[model samples]
Target: MYKVPKLNNQGTEGLEYLYIDSNGNIETSKDHSKLINDPDGVLGNTLKPLLKLPTSMPKDFGFITYNDQPPPDDKGVTPSVNSKFGHSKGLVMMDKTTGVWLLHSVPKFPFKRDNNFYPTSGAAKAQTFICVTFKYAEFQKIGQHLLDIAAFPFESHFPADFHDQLKKAAIIKWNNREPGEKIQDLESDAGTQFKSIAKKLYKGKMSACWLESEDLT
Candidate 1:
């Protein structure tokens, strides 16, 4: 079953969904997180209506790139696996100290530094894009959870040895076991300090889809 619920912490709220049974087993379910895996369904239901946006793109937001943050030395030192993840398919906002998951969006270019917005492709109609935000102290757990289910063909399984190795790596990530990275970096892997951008983009007109019905883009 796919569930879309508003998770609240303090007075703020975030969009959270899962594929699970009453016992909280995600894989046993038939859908297996299908709602978010493919199409944009929550737009008319819980998300599009209640979505909020920031007045401006917060300074804390940045793309998690594949480029080595700090370039190598003159002798051309080798880079680690984590240092080359610049496939800028998405953007994020993070603040590790207090842990704020705020506005997150695939904003068009000129808004995000050196990032361009994706345009509608060949189809009968347009499409919608969205993102979610959350906050918590258990940042590592959230990261592992997302990684476990972040792939396609959701029902696929790996061999015993490979699965065991992956689980071990996940545990190491949860336990802050990195050779050349800091705890903050690992923690931010969960996007603990990201914000949403519903209000910033649509303001009070989310349902309108546009400024006026007669005016088409």
Candidate 2:
């Protein structure tokens, strides 16, 4: 005979089963406490060594590495653009107190058609880059109360101007609008006020780093 056990946590309940094999007979039972107590140990010991395996590069060389080599004369291929939109390039600031996810657009390559082209060899294409700076204390607070912060809505806490600029960027990036179409809709003072506020808030207490679209997506 086999018995099943119920897992209870506060008001939540779940059923789990265990198995036993003797001679040619096999029996299933519910005994999940060991699984809960030492799950990592059991899973880790059962899995084969993953770290020992060597990573292989992708066969699509052009996609992986974008050398300085010029694009072929194929009509489908397009040249890279050299325009920058903002000064804070790829800034992402998360507020622990308010649970806000703020991203800043810094100046970098201008929007252009066929921005996805890459070199056939060498380093990967620089898709997008952004830098962010945040106070150490704020970061610490975020770390200490991450769960609480995560529950907050991002748009409500951010500055109105910053939100507006981000919304514009989102529209352009997400809507697949043409460069000309997006340019016509740019605000006269897109990031000026937001930058001033960010500088005041972050000041010397922040660390700046860049994250590409790949990282964010």
Cα lDDT tens digits, model 2, 1-217, are 1213232442212112233332345332223343211223222221112111112212210000011122333453543422211122221233222211122121221111122221222122112222223432233332222221111111112233333333333331332322221111111111211122211112254578876686655
- Candidate 2: count of backbone clashes, pairs at least 3 residues apart or interchain: 13
lDDT of each: 0.27, 0.23
**Per-candidate clashes, comma-separated:** 19, 13
Q: Candidate 2: misplaced stretches above 4 Å?
A: 1-88, 95-132, 135-162, 173-217
TM-score of 1: 0.23
Q: Each model's TM-score?
A: 0.23, 0.18
**lDDT of model 1 at position 118:** 18
lDDT of 2 at 127: 24
Give the best candidate by TM-score: 1
RMSD in Å for all candidates: 21.2, 23.1
